[model samples]
Target chain A: MPYGYIASMKARPGHRDEVIDILTGGADGLRTAGCHLYVVAAATTDDVTIWVSEVWESKQHHDDSLKLPEARAAIAQAMPLLTGEFFTQETEVRGGLTGQP
Target chain B: MPYGYIASMKARPGHRDEVIDILTGGADGLRTAGCHLYVVAAATTDDVTIWVSEVWESKQHHDDSLKLPEARAAIAQAMPLLTGEFFTQETEVRGGLTGQP
Candidate 1:
Protein backbone atom coordinates (compact mmCIF):
# COMPACT_ATOMS: atom_id res chain seq x y z
CA MET A 1 0.00 0.00 0.00
CA PRO A 2 1.21 3.48 -0.82
CA TYR A 3 1.25 6.46 1.48
CA GLY A 4 -0.35 9.65 0.33
CA TYR A 5 0.60 13.10 1.55
CA ILE A 6 -1.19 16.31 0.88
CA ALA A 7 0.21 19.56 2.15
CA SER A 8 -1.02 23.10 1.74
CA MET A 9 1.47 25.93 1.85
CA LYS A 10 1.31 29.67 1.53
CA ALA A 11 4.29 31.65 0.28
CA ARG A 12 5.22 35.11 1.32
CA PRO A 13 3.95 37.66 -1.12
CA GLY A 14 6.02 37.52 -4.36
CA HIS A 15 7.73 34.27 -3.38
CA ARG A 16 5.23 31.78 -4.76
CA ASP A 17 7.19 31.09 -7.88
CA GLU A 18 10.38 30.62 -5.93
CA VAL A 19 8.74 28.06 -3.69
CA ILE A 20 7.33 26.24 -6.69
CA ASP A 21 10.69 26.21 -8.37
CA ILE A 22 12.38 24.73 -5.34
CA LEU A 23 9.68 22.12 -5.11
CA THR A 24 9.93 21.30 -8.80
CA GLY A 25 13.67 21.05 -8.65
CA GLY A 26 13.54 18.61 -5.76
CA ALA A 27 10.80 16.49 -7.34
CA ASP A 28 13.03 14.39 -9.57
CA GLY A 29 15.34 13.43 -6.74
CA LEU A 30 12.37 12.30 -4.67
CA ARG A 31 11.52 9.75 -7.35
CA THR A 32 14.72 7.87 -6.67
CA ALA A 33 13.36 6.86 -3.31
CA GLY A 34 10.02 5.23 -4.13
CA CYS A 35 8.26 8.55 -4.55
CA HIS A 36 5.60 7.53 -7.00
CA LEU A 37 4.04 10.89 -7.47
CA TYR A 38 4.99 14.41 -6.49
CA VAL A 39 2.75 17.01 -8.04
CA VAL A 40 3.20 20.65 -7.13
CA ALA A 41 0.62 23.16 -8.17
CA ALA A 42 0.01 26.85 -7.76
CA ALA A 43 -3.45 27.90 -6.80
CA THR A 44 -5.45 29.69 -9.41
CA THR A 45 -7.68 31.39 -6.86
CA ASP A 46 -4.99 32.51 -4.45
CA ASP A 47 -1.69 33.79 -5.74
CA VAL A 48 0.44 32.76 -2.77
CA THR A 49 -1.08 29.41 -2.06
CA ILE A 50 0.38 26.14 -3.31
CA TRP A 51 -0.62 22.51 -3.02
CA VAL A 52 1.50 19.39 -3.06
CA SER A 53 0.18 15.85 -3.48
CA GLU A 54 2.49 12.92 -3.12
CA VAL A 55 2.37 9.15 -3.27
CA TRP A 56 5.18 7.13 -1.81
CA GLU A 57 5.56 3.36 -1.80
CA SER A 58 5.09 3.27 1.95
CA LYS A 59 5.19 5.35 5.06
CA GLN A 60 8.83 4.52 5.70
CA HIS A 61 9.72 5.48 2.18
CA HIS A 62 8.20 8.90 2.71
CA ASP A 63 9.85 9.33 6.07
CA ASP A 64 13.21 8.33 4.67
CA SER A 65 12.90 10.78 1.78
CA LEU A 66 13.17 13.79 4.07
CA LYS A 67 16.60 12.60 5.16
CA LEU A 68 17.87 12.70 1.58
CA PRO A 69 20.37 15.48 0.89
CA GLU A 70 18.39 17.02 -1.92
CA ALA A 71 15.22 16.89 0.10
CA ARG A 72 16.87 18.58 3.03
CA ALA A 73 18.38 21.23 0.80
CA ALA A 74 15.10 21.92 -0.92
CA ILE A 75 13.40 22.34 2.42
CA ALA A 76 16.05 24.75 3.59
CA GLN A 77 15.76 26.75 0.39
CA ALA A 78 11.99 26.82 0.53
CA MET A 79 11.75 27.73 4.19
CA PRO A 80 12.24 31.46 3.76
CA LEU A 81 9.68 31.77 0.99
CA LEU A 82 7.04 29.93 3.02
CA THR A 83 4.70 31.81 5.32
CA GLY A 84 4.75 28.89 7.79
CA GLU A 85 0.98 28.59 7.62
CA PHE A 86 0.55 25.07 6.40
CA PHE A 87 -1.48 21.93 7.09
CA THR A 88 -0.42 18.42 6.23
CA GLN A 89 -2.56 15.36 5.68
CA GLU A 90 -1.12 11.87 5.52
CA THR A 91 -3.27 9.19 3.98
CA GLU A 92 -3.34 5.50 3.14
CA VAL A 93 -3.68 5.67 -0.60
CA ARG A 94 -6.41 3.21 -1.55
CA GLY A 95 -6.11 3.65 -5.29
CA GLY A 96 -5.84 6.30 -7.98
CA LEU A 97 -4.25 6.99 -11.32
CA THR A 98 -1.16 8.47 -9.76
CA GLY A 99 -0.74 5.51 -7.45
CA GLN A 100 -0.79 3.05 -10.30
CA PRO A 101 2.33 1.09 -11.18
CA MET B 1 -3.27 20.97 -20.49
CA PRO B 2 -5.02 19.52 -17.47
CA TYR B 3 -6.29 21.28 -14.36
CA GLY B 4 -5.14 20.10 -10.97
CA TYR B 5 -7.02 20.63 -7.74
CA ILE B 6 -5.82 19.72 -4.28
CA ALA B 7 -8.12 20.25 -1.35
CA SER B 8 -7.68 19.58 2.35
CA MET B 9 -10.74 18.88 4.43
CA LYS B 10 -11.30 18.26 8.10
CA ALA B 11 -14.11 16.04 9.19
CA ARG B 12 -16.54 17.09 11.90
CA PRO B 13 -15.30 15.29 14.95
CA GLY B 14 -15.65 11.64 13.92
CA HIS B 15 -17.05 11.90 10.46
CA ARG B 16 -13.84 11.15 8.58
CA ASP B 17 -14.88 7.82 7.16
CA GLU B 18 -18.24 9.13 6.03
CA VAL B 19 -16.67 12.04 4.19
CA ILE B 20 -14.23 9.69 2.51
CA ASP B 21 -17.06 7.43 1.48
CA ILE B 22 -18.95 10.25 -0.18
CA LEU B 23 -15.83 11.33 -1.99
CA THR B 24 -15.00 7.83 -3.13
CA GLY B 25 -18.49 7.27 -4.36
CA GLY B 26 -18.29 10.32 -6.55
CA ALA B 27 -14.92 9.54 -8.08
CA ASP B 28 -16.10 7.37 -10.93
CA GLY B 29 -18.74 9.81 -12.14
CA LEU B 30 -16.15 12.54 -12.42
CA ARG B 31 -14.20 10.50 -14.93
CA THR B 32 -17.05 10.77 -17.41
CA ALA B 33 -16.28 14.43 -17.92
CA GLY B 34 -12.58 13.99 -18.70
CA CYS B 35 -11.51 13.88 -15.09
CA HIS B 36 -8.18 12.11 -15.17
CA LEU B 37 -7.78 11.48 -11.48
CA TYR B 38 -9.83 11.82 -8.33
CA VAL B 39 -7.92 10.50 -5.35
CA VAL B 40 -9.50 10.54 -1.89
CA ALA B 41 -7.10 9.99 0.96
CA ALA B 42 -7.45 9.79 4.72
CA ALA B 43 -4.76 11.54 6.69
CA THR B 44 -2.40 9.22 8.53
CA THR B 45 -1.38 11.81 11.13
CA ASP B 46 -4.87 13.16 11.73
CA ASP B 47 -7.80 10.85 11.84
CA VAL B 48 -10.26 13.57 10.95
CA THR B 49 -8.43 15.03 8.01
CA ILE B 50 -8.99 14.02 4.39
CA TRP B 51 -7.28 15.07 1.20
CA VAL B 52 -8.53 15.11 -2.34
CA SER B 53 -6.38 15.39 -5.45
CA GLU B 54 -8.02 15.88 -8.81
CA VAL B 55 -6.87 16.08 -12.41
CA TRP B 56 -9.10 17.03 -15.27
CA GLU B 57 -8.49 17.32 -18.98
CA SER B 58 -8.96 21.07 -18.73
CA LYS B 59 -10.21 23.72 -16.37
CA GLN B 60 -13.52 23.68 -18.15
CA HIS B 61 -13.72 19.94 -17.66
CA HIS B 62 -13.42 20.39 -13.94
CA ASP B 63 -15.95 23.20 -13.80
CA ASP B 64 -18.40 21.32 -15.91
CA SER B 65 -18.16 18.23 -13.74
CA LEU B 66 -19.39 20.27 -10.82
CA LYS B 67 -22.54 21.00 -12.76
CA LEU B 68 -23.23 17.30 -13.17
CA PRO B 69 -25.85 15.71 -10.97
CA GLU B 70 -23.49 13.23 -9.36
CA ALA B 71 -20.94 15.83 -8.47
CA ARG B 72 -23.56 18.11 -6.99
CA ALA B 73 -25.04 15.28 -5.00
CA ALA B 74 -21.68 14.22 -3.63
CA ILE B 75 -20.85 17.78 -2.61
CA ALA B 76 -24.15 18.15 -0.84
CA GLN B 77 -23.68 14.87 0.98
CA ALA B 78 -20.12 15.55 2.00
CA MET B 79 -20.78 19.14 3.11
CA PRO B 80 -22.52 18.20 6.31
CA LEU B 81 -19.70 15.98 7.47
CA LEU B 82 -17.05 18.59 6.77
CA THR B 83 -15.82 21.19 9.26
CA GLY B 84 -15.60 23.84 6.55
CA GLU B 85 -11.92 24.39 7.34
CA PHE B 86 -10.73 23.23 3.96
CA PHE B 87 -8.33 25.04 1.63
CA THR B 88 -8.27 24.47 -2.10
CA GLN B 89 -5.53 25.00 -4.66
CA GLU B 90 -6.14 25.08 -8.39
CA THR B 91 -3.16 24.33 -10.56
CA GLU B 92 -2.41 24.13 -14.26
CA VAL B 93 -1.17 20.52 -13.95
CA ARG B 94 1.79 20.73 -16.33
CA GLY B 95 2.35 16.99 -16.38
CA GLY B 96 2.23 13.89 -14.20
CA LEU B 97 1.68 10.13 -14.30
CA THR B 98 -1.98 10.54 -13.53
CA GLY B 99 -2.42 13.28 -16.11
CA GLN B 100 -0.81 11.18 -18.86
CA PRO B 101 -2.70 10.29 -22.00
Candidate 2:
Protein backbone atom coordinates (compact mmCIF):
# COMPACT_ATOMS: atom_id res chain seq x y z
CA MET A 1 0.00 0.00 0.00
CA PRO A 2 1.09 3.56 -0.62
CA TYR A 3 2.24 5.45 2.46
CA GLY A 4 0.92 8.89 3.20
CA TYR A 5 0.36 11.48 5.84
CA ILE A 6 -1.47 14.74 6.38
CA ALA A 7 0.57 17.02 8.61
CA SER A 8 0.40 20.55 9.82
CA MET A 9 3.05 22.91 11.13
CA LYS A 10 3.03 26.41 12.47
CA ALA A 11 5.35 29.08 11.14
CA ARG A 12 6.83 31.88 13.19
CA PRO A 13 4.29 34.71 13.06
CA GLY A 14 5.48 36.45 9.93
CA HIS A 15 7.10 33.51 8.14
CA ARG A 16 4.30 31.32 6.85
CA ASP A 17 4.74 32.26 3.23
CA GLU A 18 8.49 31.79 3.37
CA VAL A 19 8.00 28.41 4.99
CA ILE A 20 5.48 27.49 2.34
CA ASP A 21 7.90 28.47 -0.39
CA ILE A 22 10.65 26.34 1.08
CA LEU A 23 8.31 23.40 1.42
CA THR A 24 6.88 23.61 -2.10
CA GLY A 25 10.22 24.39 -3.71
CA GLY A 26 11.45 20.84 -3.35
CA ALA A 27 8.67 19.20 -5.36
CA ASP A 28 10.84 18.24 -8.32
CA GLY A 29 13.25 16.28 -6.18
CA LEU A 30 10.38 14.65 -4.34
CA ARG A 31 8.73 13.47 -7.54
CA THR A 32 11.89 11.83 -8.72
CA ALA A 33 12.39 10.35 -5.29
CA GLY A 34 9.18 8.29 -5.57
CA CYS A 35 6.47 10.57 -4.41
CA HIS A 36 2.97 10.06 -5.72
CA LEU A 37 1.44 13.20 -4.32
CA TYR A 38 2.67 16.24 -2.41
CA VAL A 39 0.25 19.03 -1.66
CA VAL A 40 1.16 22.14 0.31
CA ALA A 41 -1.68 24.21 1.56
CA ALA A 42 -2.48 27.00 3.97
CA ALA A 43 -4.96 26.61 6.80
CA THR A 44 -7.82 28.75 5.62
CA THR A 45 -8.72 30.28 8.96
CA ASP A 46 -5.21 30.96 10.19
CA ASP A 47 -2.22 32.93 9.02
CA VAL A 48 0.56 30.85 10.51
CA THR A 49 -0.43 27.26 9.98
CA ILE A 50 0.39 25.19 6.88
CA TRP A 51 -0.82 21.78 5.92
CA VAL A 52 0.92 19.23 3.73
CA SER A 53 -0.69 16.09 2.44
CA GLU A 54 1.66 13.59 0.86
CA VAL A 55 1.63 10.11 -0.64
CA TRP A 56 4.75 8.19 -1.41
CA GLU A 57 5.45 5.00 -3.30
CA SER A 58 6.38 3.41 -0.02
CA LYS A 59 7.30 4.20 3.56
CA GLN A 60 10.94 3.65 2.71
CA HIS A 61 10.67 6.17 -0.08
CA HIS A 62 9.33 8.74 2.32
CA ASP A 63 12.10 8.03 4.80
CA ASP A 64 14.75 8.26 2.17
CA SER A 65 13.41 11.49 0.75
CA LEU A 66 14.03 13.23 4.00
CA LYS A 67 17.65 12.34 3.74
CA LEU A 68 18.07 13.72 0.26
CA PRO A 69 20.23 16.82 -0.02
CA GLU A 70 17.50 19.05 -1.32
CA ALA A 71 15.04 17.77 1.21
CA ARG A 72 17.44 18.23 4.09
CA ALA A 73 18.34 21.70 2.95
CA ALA A 74 14.73 22.69 2.68
CA ILE A 75 13.93 21.35 6.12
CA ALA A 76 16.93 23.12 7.63
CA GLN A 77 15.89 26.41 6.10
CA ALA A 78 12.30 26.10 7.24
CA MET A 79 13.02 24.90 10.75
CA PRO A 80 14.13 28.25 12.06
CA LEU A 81 11.01 29.83 10.69
CA LEU A 82 8.77 27.29 12.36
CA THR A 83 7.38 27.22 15.85
CA GLY A 84 7.83 23.44 16.37
CA GLU A 85 4.09 22.95 16.71
CA PHE A 86 2.96 20.15 14.45
CA PHE A 87 0.23 17.62 13.89
CA THR A 88 0.53 14.47 11.83
CA GLN A 89 -1.73 11.61 10.88
CA GLU A 90 -0.02 8.80 9.07
CA THR A 91 -2.18 6.92 6.58
CA GLU A 92 -2.38 4.10 4.12
CA VAL A 93 -3.68 5.37 0.83
CA ARG A 94 -6.49 3.12 -0.32
CA GLY A 95 -7.84 4.83 -3.38
CA GLY A 96 -8.64 8.24 -4.79
CA LEU A 97 -8.71 10.68 -7.72
CA THR A 98 -5.33 11.98 -8.84
CA GLY A 99 -3.93 14.30 -11.54
CA GLN A 100 -6.81 16.74 -11.66
CA PRO A 101 -5.40 19.72 -9.84
CA MET B 1 -8.19 29.30 -5.49
CA PRO B 2 -8.95 25.61 -5.11
CA TYR B 3 -10.63 24.49 -1.92
CA GLY B 4 -9.68 21.42 0.03
CA TYR B 5 -9.54 19.77 3.44
CA ILE B 6 -8.23 16.68 5.10
CA ALA B 7 -10.81 15.31 7.48
CA SER B 8 -11.01 12.17 9.51
CA MET B 9 -13.92 10.19 10.92
CA LYS B 10 -13.88 7.25 13.23
CA ALA B 11 -15.92 4.15 12.57
CA ARG B 12 -17.55 1.97 15.14
CA PRO B 13 -15.45 -1.01 16.12
CA GLY B 14 -15.33 -3.67 13.40
CA HIS B 15 -17.03 -1.36 10.91
CA ARG B 16 -14.11 0.43 9.31
CA ASP B 17 -14.36 -1.46 6.04
CA GLU B 18 -18.06 -0.80 5.77
CA VAL B 19 -17.54 2.88 6.33
CA ILE B 20 -14.72 2.96 3.79
CA ASP B 21 -16.92 1.28 1.22
CA ILE B 22 -19.64 3.79 1.71
CA LEU B 23 -17.22 6.69 1.45
CA THR B 24 -15.32 5.50 -1.61
CA GLY B 25 -18.52 4.39 -3.29
CA GLY B 26 -19.56 7.96 -3.84
CA ALA B 27 -16.54 8.95 -5.91
CA ASP B 28 -18.23 8.91 -9.29
CA GLY B 29 -20.82 11.42 -8.34
CA LEU B 30 -18.25 13.48 -6.50
CA ARG B 31 -16.18 13.80 -9.63
CA THR B 32 -19.18 14.92 -11.61
CA ALA B 33 -19.94 17.34 -8.83
CA GLY B 34 -16.65 19.16 -9.55
CA CYS B 35 -14.24 17.39 -7.25
CA HIS B 36 -10.64 17.62 -8.29
CA LEU B 37 -9.38 14.96 -5.91
CA TYR B 38 -11.01 12.65 -3.39
CA VAL B 39 -8.80 10.30 -1.42
CA VAL B 40 -10.08 7.79 1.11
CA ALA B 41 -7.46 6.51 3.47
CA ALA B 42 -7.10 4.44 6.61
CA ALA B 43 -5.09 5.55 9.58
CA THR B 44 -1.90 3.48 9.72
CA THR B 45 -1.90 2.88 13.43
CA ASP B 46 -5.59 2.50 14.09
CA ASP B 47 -8.47 0.35 12.99
CA VAL B 48 -11.39 2.75 13.32
CA THR B 49 -10.21 6.03 11.91
CA ILE B 50 -10.62 6.82 8.23
CA TRP B 51 -9.12 9.86 6.59
CA VAL B 52 -10.47 11.61 3.53
CA SER B 53 -8.46 14.22 1.67
CA GLU B 54 -10.27 16.20 -0.97
CA VAL B 55 -9.86 19.11 -3.35
CA TRP B 56 -12.76 20.70 -5.18
CA GLU B 57 -12.98 23.33 -7.84
CA SER B 58 -14.69 25.56 -5.34
CA LYS B 59 -16.15 25.41 -1.85
CA GLN B 60 -19.58 25.63 -3.47
CA HIS B 61 -18.92 22.45 -5.42
CA HIS B 62 -18.08 20.64 -2.23
CA ASP B 63 -21.18 22.03 -0.52
CA ASP B 64 -23.41 21.01 -3.40
CA SER B 65 -22.04 17.47 -3.35
CA LEU B 66 -23.23 16.83 0.20
CA LYS B 67 -26.76 17.56 -0.96
CA LEU B 68 -26.68 15.07 -3.83
CA PRO B 69 -28.95 12.08 -3.40
CA GLU B 70 -26.14 9.59 -3.60
CA ALA B 71 -24.07 11.55 -1.12
CA ARG B 72 -26.95 11.71 1.32
CA ALA B 73 -27.55 8.00 0.94
CA ALA B 74 -23.94 7.23 1.59
CA ILE B 75 -23.88 9.45 4.65
CA ALA B 76 -27.00 7.84 6.05
CA GLN B 77 -25.63 4.35 5.48
CA ALA B 78 -22.31 5.17 7.07
CA MET B 79 -23.50 7.17 10.05
CA PRO B 80 -24.74 4.13 11.87
CA LEU B 81 -21.30 2.64 11.52
CA LEU B 82 -19.46 5.74 12.71
CA THR B 83 -18.44 6.80 16.18
CA GLY B 84 -19.22 10.52 15.68
CA GLU B 85 -15.60 11.49 16.26
CA PHE B 86 -14.31 13.74 13.52
CA PHE B 87 -11.45 16.13 12.71
CA THR B 88 -11.39 18.62 9.90
CA GLN B 89 -8.80 21.11 8.68
CA GLU B 90 -9.88 23.41 5.91
CA THR B 91 -7.21 24.55 3.46
CA GLU B 92 -6.47 26.69 0.48
CA VAL B 93 -4.44 24.52 -1.91
CA ARG B 94 -1.18 26.17 -2.85
CA GLY B 95 0.64 23.86 -5.25
CA GLY B 96 1.87 20.27 -5.63
CA LEU B 97 1.75 17.05 -7.62
CA THR B 98 -1.61 15.61 -8.57
CA GLY B 99 -2.81 12.71 -10.80
CA GLN B 100 0.10 10.43 -10.03
CA PRO B 101 -1.57 8.23 -7.47
Model 2 chain A: weakest 10-residue lDDT segment is A92-101
Q: Compose the digit string of candidate 1's lDDT tens values, residues B36-82.
A: 77777887777888778887788888888889988788899989988
Candidate 2, TM-score of its B chain:
0.96
- The reply for model 1, stretches above 4 Å from the true place, is A99-101, B10-15, B76-87, B94-101
Which candidate's lDDT is highest? 2
Fraction of native Cα-Cα interface contacts (under 8 Å, chains A and B) also present in model 1: 0.44
Clashing pairs in 1: A90-B43, A90-B44
lDDT of 2 by residue, B1-101 (tens): 89988899999999998888888876866677899888889998889999998988989999998998898898999999998999898899988877663
Model 2 error, position B81 (Å)? 0.6
Question: Alpha carbon lDDT of residue A83, candidate 2?
Answer: 97
Q: Estimate, for each residue in A1-97, the C-alpha lDDT of model 1 and write its tens digit.
A: 6788888799999999888888887565666688777777777887898888888889899999899888899899999899999977788876544
Per-model DockQ: 0.41, 0.78
Error of 2 at A64 (Å): 0.7
Q: Give the Cα-based TM-score of candidate 2 against the true structure.
A: 0.96
